[model samples]
Target: MESIKASLPDVIQQRIEDLVNAQTTDEEMAAHIKELGCRIAALEALAPEEKGEEAGQLGEAVHRLCERIRRDYVAIAYRQGLVDGMRMDKLAAEE
Candidate 1:
């Protein structure tokens, strides 16, 4: 896991570190972490078990870390009106 962390993209690692260091309300943080855990678990459950065990493990870890950062920071930002929500309807209309 240490080696895996070392190999992650700098931007991703920095984001994770930022999340770990952030000072946010506990309720918000807990909700974000819970969302991240659910997302990671769903992804892991969908992954096939037979091929490239190491790759699967690495992918799962990355997914988990990314989810954590996104949930903690991105979600909070969206909720606080700092970041805009996804406009799926606009995207569909464009297509």
Candidate 2:
């Protein structure tokens, strides 16, 4: 969680704010996940399969890092759905 904050505190903060302030539905989260998958695919395509190249290795590392972030976002979005389903949002609010 600290690593995530260090990397994208703004994004995470904005997402949480959005979830709390608006009707962020599960459908929207699913679409974001699908879009991330498409973006990852395109990124992987740009990094050729050849080995021993420093750039490709760096790109692969970055790809994995991005995948991790995307997974975290998915979890966040799913939890938002759960909170809404339970009506927990009513108990929580941002000032």
lDDT of each prediction vs. the true structure?
0.59, 0.61
* Candidate 1 residue lDDT tens string, 66-86: 668767776665554422113
lDDT for position 79 in model 2: 87
On TM-score, the candidate that comes out on top is: 2
Cα deviation of 78, candidate 2, in Å: 0.4
For all candidates, what are the clash counts?
0, 0
Tens-digit per-residue lDDT, 1-95, candidate 2? 44343435555576678858754367875786677666656666676567336555565676678668767877987887675544433333211
Q: Estimate each model's TM-score.
A: 0.34, 0.38
Per-residue error (Å), model 2, residue 51: 11
